[model samples]
Every structure is written in C-alpha cells, then in structure tokens.
Target: MIVRPSLTRSIPFWILLVASLAVTVAGAAIVATTLPAMIAGLDDQTATGGLVYGGQSWITIGSGLLAAGLVGLFVLLALAAARSFLPVVKPTADAIEADDAETGDDTVLVRTDEVVPARDEVPAAR
Candidate 1:
C-alpha cells in the first residue's frame, strides 16, 4: 500500500517552504526599494559616470537574478534531501486492538527486518 503523508504530519516541510518564500519576498522588496537610490549615488560630473551607473545597475540586476536562481536551486535540493528524511509513523498497539475488534481475530502478525548491519560488526563468511 502506498501511503501519502498528510499536511498535519508534515508541518516542518510546510514551515520551511513558507519561510523560504517569505525570505525571497523580503529580499526582493529590499532590492526594489534601495536599487534606484544606489544608482543615483553612483552619478558624477563626467558623462562616463552615467554609463558606469547604468552598467552598475545591469550588473546589480544580473547578480540579483543569479542569486535568486541559486537560492531556488538550493531550496529544491534541500526539499529533495528532506524527502529522504521524512518521519516514519509506526502503527500503535491501539490500532491493532481496533483491527482485532473489527475482524474478531486477536492475532495480528507483524514482520520487520533490518536492512543495514552495524558498521563495527564483521561480515559473515559465505
């Protein structure tokens, strides 16, 4: 059976996603409000100053785009990494009791196996 995680159970994932979005929006807002003032400060008497300021603006914009892209890439990577570490919910004895009550069978068999051995232990010879 394929089990999908519920939103209530995945609170941390949702929190991280919301926090990332909030930070991105805050960063964009700061840049939008400050960039023009920064460009104006770069102006000087020489004609080359205007060219320099324009180039600076483009460079700032390019760097911001690159940073945003990198942040997105990293966030995606973090989510992928987090997927591998999601919490596993084990069925409690209460659940088994409910199952038994419905089926009129007291016996419920559960089998579990360890996939990995302890690192300190030596492997068995074939």
Candidate 2:
C-alpha cells in the first residue's frame, strides 16, 4: 500500500500559522499607530485621562495579541521541527515489491571507446 500524506492533519496547522502571523502584524501595526498619538496628546488636560486611557487600552490589547501570536508561532514551529505536525509515510512490503517490478533491471555497460548503435538503427546479425 502506498501511503500518501493526509491533508486533514496539516490543514489546521497551516491555518493557525497564517492566522498567527496576521495577528502579530496587526498587533504591531496597532501599537505603532497608537503610540505617537498618545504621546503627542499628553499635554492637554482634556486628552490626558480619556485619550491616554483609551490608548493604553489599545496598547494592552495589542500587546496581548502580539504575545499570544508569538507564543502560537513558536509552538507551531517547534512542533513542525519535531515532525509532530507532519504526516508520516510508511512503505509496505507490497509497495516495495511493486516499485521494484515497475523499475525492472535494464542497465547496460559500454566502454568510452566503443560506439553503440541506436536501437532502431542496429544491424541484424548475419
């Protein structure tokens, strides 16, 4: 029996990998965009509490997302490296025999100095 890699085992990991990357990037972008505004608005009394609080909230959420994504990515990569996330292919005796028979021995040896005629152009023995 020829063992093929199963997609069912790998599809979820692939989805998780993509999702983790997207979440990481989105978190980084949110933090990057929110920091400058919060810093710039710190002087105004009206912007101090509400603006700073909202920005801090976003920053916290973004940091959490970034951390979660990083942890997920690390775990997935480790699992992949350890071969836990990949499908294993096992070769059976029947498969080995079939492969061998399919590739029957047809090896030929020829010296560099000897000229070998093409099969279609070979002369018949007299």
Candidate 3:
C-alpha cells in the first residue's frame, strides 16, 4: 500500500501538533468573526457563542483522530524496524548442546507445563 508521510512514523508528532494548532486557530478565527454578526442579526448570544464552542469541539475531535492515526503509524514503524533488526530469532543448538554437556542438564528436562506438587507432597518449609 501507499506508505505516505505520517505523523508518528515519518512526518513526526510535532508537525501534526502544529497542524492541529493551525486548524484550531483557523476554525476559531472563523467562529470569532461570525459570532458578532450572528449576535447582531439573530439576537441569539448563546448560539453565537456556540459557534466558537462547536469549532473547538470539532478541533478536539480532529486532534484525537490525528493522535490515533499517528499512534498506529508509529506501531507499524516499530514492528517493521524490529522485524528487520531481529530476523529469524531461532535458538542456537550449540548453546543447548554445551549446556547439556557441561551441566548434565539433558535429563533434567525442564518442561514448561510441568505440574507443581501440592503443599502436602512438597517438603515442609523450615
């Protein structure tokens, strides 16, 4: 797909933040300019005030969306980086062989799903 410049991945959070601020300021300016005229003509001060409030509300919504998008972008970037840096992470057989040879750990067989003995079966703690 198109991996365009994103906030967290490429464009950076600070740029997105600046964009949010600019959009918010522009929206606020539009509301501020319209409110006085709305008050004079419509004679509804509350509605006039609500114009700015609505602008702010929508700005907050846009910021939240931007943040979410950026977070996802960053996660993808991180996953890609990790995949590249740590490809095919298989355990080396030589290490296991060395451990078995040196420590006689072959027969120990530390099973991951081994059941633990109950308190009665276990030796009492001094």
Candidate 4:
C-alpha cells in the first residue's frame, strides 16, 4: 500500500524525480539499443561508439557535481547579497567608540495593564 502526500509539497518533487528517471532510463535504453546499429552504420567506428557511451556516463557523473556546485554557488551568492543589505555591526571597543550618531534621544514607554486574566477563575470562600 502506498501513502499519498498532499500536492503542496511532495507531489512536485516526486513528479520531477519520476519524470527525470523515466527520461534517463528511456534515453539510455534507446542509446544502448541504437549503439550497435549506429556503429555498424558508421563503419564499425569504435571511437564514436565509445564516445557515445562516454558522453552519457559523463553526463550522469556531471549531473550530481553540477547540481552541488550550483547549489554552493547560489548559497554563496545569497550570503553575499544578504550581507550587503545588513547594517555593519561593530564589536570591538575601538570600533564602538569610533561610532558617532545623533537622534532626537526621546523614548516613549507604552503601558498596557488593563486586567484580563483567565476565563477559568472561581470565587474563593471568604
């Protein structure tokens, strides 16, 4: 028995995985089945046949590495972008002392203490 997940989350990833696997499998099957014919047609060119298999193998290997590299690149890019938007925070005493800023210097305190405690209170015996 298979459990189904909601469309909002699991479906998209499953769909992509299934589709990619199907395409890769079907493509490899086609390439495998066609390789001999292709080689024979091209006068038994071993180099070409090897190149075809090698290319597919490289594509398989490169896919994971490419995905990882791109993910890492994007993470770095996102971090850099976020850093640009953030205010520089000073830490050391020297840096803190070097800071000079001016504002109205007025502070407002908001008092919020009108009582509404709980709904489950019972009167105590006096």
Among these predictions, the greatest TM-score belongs to: 2
Question: How many residue pairs clash in model 2?
Answer: 0
lDDT to native, each model: 0.56, 0.68, 0.50, 0.46
Q: Residue by residue across 1-126, what tens digits does model 3's lDDT show?
A: 111222345445556555655655565555565545555545554555465666456556655655665665566567556544432222345645665777786643222322323223556799
Name the regions of candidate 1 deviating beyond 4 angstroms.
1-9, 44-76, 81-126
lDDT of candidate 2 vs native?
0.68
Q: Model 2, residue 29: what's the lDDT?
A: 83
Model 4 stretches astray by more than 4 angstroms:
1-50, 91-126
Model 2 misplaced regions, further than 4 Å: 1-9, 43-46, 84-90, 93-126
What would the per-residue lDDT of candidate 1 be over residues 1-126, giving only the tens digit for each residue?
A: 122354445777566566666656665665665555555665643445555666567556655754675586577567767665654444456665666677777554322222222134576999
* lDDT tens digits, residue span 28-94, model 2: 8889888878988875544667779999999999888888889889988786775533334445455
Give the Å shift of residue 50 in candidate 2: 2.0
Q: Which ten residues in a row have the lowest lDDT in candidate 1?
A: 110-119
- The TM-score of predicted model 2 comes to 0.60
What local lDDT does model 2 show for residue 75? 80
Please name the candidate that would achieve the greatest lDDT relative to the true structure.
2
TM-score per candidate = 0.38, 0.60, 0.33, 0.32
Q: Which candidate would rank higher by lDDT, 2 or 3?
A: 2
